[model samples]
Target: MPKADAESPQAPVDPRLLRYASASRGFFVAIAAIALAQTVVIVAFAWLLTRAITSAIDGMPVAELAPTLGWLAAVVAVRAALLWAREAVAARAAARVQTQLRSALVAAVGALGPEWLAARGSASLAITAGRGLDALEAYFGRYLPQLVQTVVATPLILVVMWWQDWISGLTVLLTLPLIPVFMVLIGLATRSVQQRQWQTLQHLASRFADTVQGLSTLKVFGRQHRAAASVERVTDQYRRETMRVLRVSFLSGFTLEFLASISVAIVAVSIGFRLIDGALTLAVGLFVLLLAPEAYLPLRQVGVQFHAAAEGVAATEDVFAVLDAARASKGSAAGSADSHSPVPEPHPAVPELVEGRLVVRDLRVHRGGGMLPPLSFSARPGTVTLLEGPSGAGKSSVFAALRGAAAFDGTAELGGADVRALAPSQWLAWAGQQPGLLAGTIAGNVTLGDPAPDTAAVSRALDLACAQALDPALELGVQGAGLSGGQAQRVAVARAIYRHLRGLAPVVALDEPSSALDAQTEARLWRGIRSLADEGATVLLISHRTSARAIADTVVHLEPSEVPA
Candidate 1:
């Protein structure tokens, strides 16, 4: 069996950041524009402060101060508006990227097929597709753009400070590198902690979903207490992992804060000495002091947001791993091959009727463990072949094999074409022992999202399957819960009959179709099966009951151990 790839317990690498870098290029440009606008506003604010102070010192006049303050207020408002626009644009871009990622993930999973999916727990997929994606919101919406602005804006701010005084500028230049260096070291540490946290979360989600799905089984077997204990153990582990994540998060924040604080202090001390020594004017000294914090601001903010976004980046890596796994071939077979020698004309024997002939030659099915014995049989048009065996005899597996589900070793031809080559919609409708019925009325369940079947056709199918007890208007609760087992089985038979009449497929396989039905209802079901055969459709019936073979034209017995137990 191909197991789901053993994903590294370490955080998977996320390409979304690179994707964000490319997809959000326009956003990056907008961020750069906003940063430039902000720099202009900062410079204007600083110059205005200086002019106001100098004029006040000279007692130049009170009236002149009003216009200066007014201009400064206008500059502040414009800066605020531009900041809002920048954030809005970045958020929209993030949403678009997230949408694209989700669609890609869904498509990749779809292509991997159900057999591949069966190897993994649903909880892991749910977490990756659902909660994991939620984590990326902050990473894309805020952290990414801020990261760009920090890299772009910080340097421009430093240049302006350098123009003011090379000493202060050089002090900033030297100290600035420390913030990111310390951040990188701390981020690396935090990454491991976040990855562990996400793993614990996936384990917990898987346990919870499995427990809920099996709740009825657990109750019937009186194993609820045991299951509850398992759940508690999982929840305890999750709690501990969560605390570990929080501890790392706080530590990362403190690391960034400490590094940034020290750098700012270094700049402040250098400027203060210059002011005392009269190497810097008081006005220029004040300006340098004001600008020092601004230069370090983006770095400090990056630290805070990075911690917030860490969980998302960690989750994204796992999602991408799933995408990578999906790129592998889902099944062993490539494509269908022609089973008939010199294939018959496209329009064959029965043009108006949706009847089909089935031919099985040296058919061998191999599940993960071993090869099931090769068996061969054929069902002519207008005949029913009964497949009989005890449970776990590979009876249903035979149906699945005919449906082109796993690696099978031989050939199944339908209407002269290989069954493997037949498109799923071509000529097979294998209804399992438990028919899947959506939540809807009897008509809805029968039609199964197809346009509503005509009333006359539906009435005939229902009457034939002996499901007249169910009202077409009555609501079938979720998964046909409102119906009795016998009623549900009859409804499934009705669906099969309806599909055959509508020409959906020429061959219909039923697995234990009468398992839940009463003797009278079972008789009615056999009548319906015979009626289908009479209409020239090929019918393959699987059942353990000896009486089921009474309605068959032939019987193929499979050993008990050949089926999945």
Candidate 2:
């Protein structure tokens, strides 16, 4: 297990935040315009209210009220239109940012490679890529623009209030700091809650994913009830954590709302006293009273939305954690290898040519808290080396070491160059006992990441693997679900053979490649392996079964340790 480093730099701030902040420029401007429009609407409505009240007091004609009422209604209509536009623009901006974020995340994960992925389980990744990112919708679509509006519009509203009446304006301005101060305190408290919530979510997701993946195994072993109990325990913990977060969230919102309400009431009382003293006109006093709540409305909304969005920000931090881990050493390793020597040119197309000259001298593997013996072996071009050993004699460990699956001691050399020093994309292909088949047509899986293979090449490889009976055009189903074990192995062989034909690499290491096959099918598989060697590729086969030994140019045997008697 890898140890966490305390001194290591914390994961960088989420790229989504940066992307959102940048993309939200238009959204912020739109919101500012809407707020300004709303202010005009509020002032107009106040004017109309004052006009009617003063007119009633002075005994003005009732017919004269029509124009003022019409103007107030128009202001409301225009404000409604601006609000619609603002929402539309903000939504568009949010969507654009989300797309960019998802793309960046996918690219970052791709760069991390299988080793980092192995350390971080697929369930955690699924959460990050799936529901984890969904959390950001609120952060981007709602909270972000409101945050910007609060920063810009709050000051402007305060300034307008001061212009109309300094006392009420100063009251709002003085008490305004209390809202955010209280918010900051609550935010600090909620941070820990958010972190715990996110952790629980990851645990739950991982447990659920693992359970589903192992459902078949549990049923076969008569352990479905045990699996359900495990899931129930995890879900119960998740429930407890969720309740904790919600409790804190409700408390934060209640506190902020109570404080904001008090501030608004203080402003209202001050305005009312000024009106009673005749220091302020009725129109101005009512306007100030109405604008007090409007001014703080965005900030108040932010407090509530902030609690909802904290989970998203916390999850975003985890997403960045995965991306940072993936890209960590990729640059230095790739750069150092590239700077050392120019890559060799590809060999000309030939039916068969010996290229791989693998040399393993003093190779050692450390795994499961034990160090295996120093392993030394060689597989020359056009030779199949059958590696045979007892169940725990490290035969598969040798395959892993050759293919760079785990870190090891000593040197593995390919054509006189250290294998560790070789770029991973160079010189090796590995197939395990259970070959991994993604969901796709057989031809697509066979080609893997290569450019789509032509019809002829696909046909030839399938025919060679004795999978001609399997349609290349048919979908393989999830994990090759529709195929038998032997069929899957044969397709895997076809994939390796396809890569070999493409000249992508010169060596192949297979761990129990024919383990699931019967005698005849195993024979056909070994015949294909021999043909690969005959075609100038170095082949390393790991299996305990003796039948696979026939095609090997050499057989290396490993013995388990016991007291020598």
Candidate 3:
């Protein structure tokens, strides 16, 4: 978790955040209006208090100053009320914008889909969306409102101070520039510190995720100790970086306060001299003295809160970068060969397709800056089709293209109609080589993303995929920890099988489904695959195993395309 240090120096707030704040314009307007009102009350309170004090010094009766004192009390009350309202409005605005920004980011990520997001690790993206956006709370609640006060109240108080005593006002004016100058000097250091801290935080999160995901593999290879050492090193680095940020924040805050206090002391001293010489009235001198500190207060707060909002600003930058990349990819894909291919007719809202004939004719897929050779295959309903290729043979690329994740040239059709025309979710039941187990119940992973999951169908699918060892109601830890690799793979198979059994999709596809299974479990899994094919569904499976080829009704072998030397 990122700590919010109120006194830390921060970088300038992004204008993009300001534009995002436009959504809560009314709340900010209320905040500004309330701040302006508070400024007026501050002036009145200072003037009244000075007058009451001055009257007493002039030997006026306490009773005679009662009404002036009463008005002073009333002004104090109004200022307090304005303060509360200003805080409330700022908090509300922060909550509103945080919600808006986070939702927009999540929606954009979903629109980009798994392929793009996978390229950028899920752990980093999760941190950006979760803790990153959460950091904005300080930006909105404290820093932003204080920013408004610095712009509105400080200047107004300064103007009142000027009207009361020009010399004191001139002194404040000359010294006022020092606060921001010192703030800027500190902010340069703060910005670099914050950037490093944020980067370290992201690195730590990514490393932890990677270590956890590969812990099994590490254990198998007798490298778990090495992985733990790496994790500890990363954790230590993060701790050091965090401490550095805190140190800088405290130092910057002390400097801002020292400068502000010095400026106030100078004003107080000058006013005292003027009063001893009888060059200034007691009321005016006292009023200027009181307002002097108030003039610098807002700027001081801004400098401090800037550091608190630093992490949020960095996180926002990362999220927008992801969204921008997604948009650029979509724009690029829109002009690619996939977009030019004939689009299939829109399927009905409810997926009612029970069976589909699969066809891939002269299909060339683009992936990772390379193109797969043109490939063709066909499978009738109630048949299992296998795609065979060695490593780097583009079998996975073909799967990605058929799944509509990769852009392609040529045609992929279902039942003589272009597969692109069919609703992707409605026509395809996909289980990738990676299990893709989420953090939830076994049943939940099995029925994931299904609009309406049926209990009987879920149970039957689980049984068919031979994942009965996992209790449907039992909660699984992150990434399905505690489950063996075969169990996880079977869980994914159950998910795909459930979708088809529920008639949500007609074409069931599995990528290397038997990779983790032993011969016995692999045989059972193949039976499930054959059963699905027998039930009038077109089945597509990718494999390099001879055993997989034995069960296939149709085999399509893709040779690695030659790259010229």
What C-alpha RMSD separates each model from the true structure?
4.9, 4.8, 4.0
Q: Return the TM-score for each candidate structure.
A: 0.83, 0.83, 0.90
How would you order the candidates by TM-score, starting with the best? 3, 2, 1
Give the per-residue lDDT of model 2 (tens digit) for 339-393. 8733232233322223647888787776667678887888898899988987878
* Per-residue C-alpha lDDT of model 1 across residues 341-372, encoded as one tens digit per residue: 33222233333225446888878777768878
Q: Model 3 misses residue 240 by how many Å?
A: 2.2
For each of the candidates, give the backbone clash count: 5, 0, 3
- Ordered list by lDDT, greatest first: 3, 1, 2
Runs off by more than 4 Å, candidate 3:
1-13, 18-22, 325-356, 407-410, 415-423, 468-470, 560-565
Instruction: Estimate every model's Cα lDDT from 0 to 1.
Output: 0.74, 0.73, 0.81
Better of 1 and 3 by lDDT: 3
Question: Model 2 Cα displacement at 3 (Å)?
Answer: 13
Worst 10 residues of 1 by lDDT: 329-338
- Which has the better TM-score: candidate 2, or candidate 3? 3
